[model samples]
Target: MTTAPADATVRVRYFAGARAAAGIPEETIRLAAGATVRDLVAELGSRHGDGLTRVLTACSFLLDGISVRDHGITLVDGSGVDVLPPFAGG
Candidate 1:
């Protein structure tokens, strides 16, 4: 298996509908060493165009399973950031 750099930037992974909506399986996002989760969102929004604003508003962010609402939350390299929306069904 190929290995990534130790200080390599973050990698964003979208699941289920998010992946389809984003139109990409995954992305290697380049962020500042101490970029915040909010920063990542903005970066992604830029990449996805204006549609991202609406989509992102409906989604919840998770850092390694911990729900994150504070935009100021600092992100480190190799961290997992999940963009999740509410699930519906009976």
Candidate 2:
């Protein structure tokens, strides 16, 4: 895993199955300066194990309330990243 500078952090919020997989509602992920969303996902997958990695594959992401489909997008410091797993319909 790449080491992050002390001040670089991204807040990750997990929902539904993602929350279950991560075993937490939210967490602060340390990242290298100019880290992208893909970097954060990769790091999370590594830290949380296979369950979260699986959940992440099907999950959608929101960066600071805006929907993001590209994992290559760069994450700003103190940004909020929400992980939303697919929902079942009635």
Candidate 3:
């Protein structure tokens, strides 16, 4: 399990649908120790409003370019997390 600091700040990159919803490509989210990606999403939802929930649920997490299928993945300071939603096309 990875431990985070009380002042930990992680860089989050929003892609595809998530980017469109967030209206930004990236942001630095602060959290307490042991904060997970899920936690970050919840926090973001609160800041951005309830509509974020619908979009966040469809997004997958990535750490340093590696997919994090596990929702329990711990987040720490300086970590780079990517939010990627499934692409829809013909």
Candidate 4:
């Protein structure tokens, strides 16, 4: 596993099913300087377990309030990431 740069941090916010799966509303995750959203998901999967992995596959992500579809997008330090699982009704 890659280690986080000393000064890099990503705040992850979980909503709905994601929150239920992670058992928390939010968490601060450390990452290497150039880590991507995919990396963050991998780390979270490792930390949280398979349930989160499954939930994540059906979720949408937002980076600092902007919707992000590419998991390869590099993350900015001290940015906030929101994990939004699908809602039953629009």
Best by TM-score: 4
The regions of model 1 sitting more than 4 angstroms off are 1-8
For 1-90, candidate 3 gives per-residue lDDT tens digits of 975456659898888888888878999888888888778888888877766668998888888789898877888788898888888898
Clashing pairs in 1: none
Order of quality (lDDT): 4, 2, 3, 1
How do the residues 1-90 of candidate 2 rate in per-residue lDDT, one tens digit apiece? 976554468999999999999999999998887789999999999999999999999999999999998889988778999999999999
Backbone clash total, candidate 1: 0
| Model 4 spans with C-alpha error above 4 angstroms | 1-7
* Candidate 2, run of 10 with poorest lDDT: 2-11
Task: Please provide TM-scores, in order, for all candidate models, with all chains considered together.
Answer: 0.79, 0.89, 0.85, 0.90
lDDT of 1 by residue, 43-80 (tens): 88888876655677678888877889787988877788
**Can you write out model 4's per-residue Cα lDDT over 1-90, one digit (the tens) per residue?**
986555459999999999999999999999888889999999998999999999999999999999998999998788999999998976
Ten residues in a row with the worst lDDT in model 1? 2-11
Mark the regions of model 2 whose C-alpha exceeds 4 Å error after superposition. 1-7
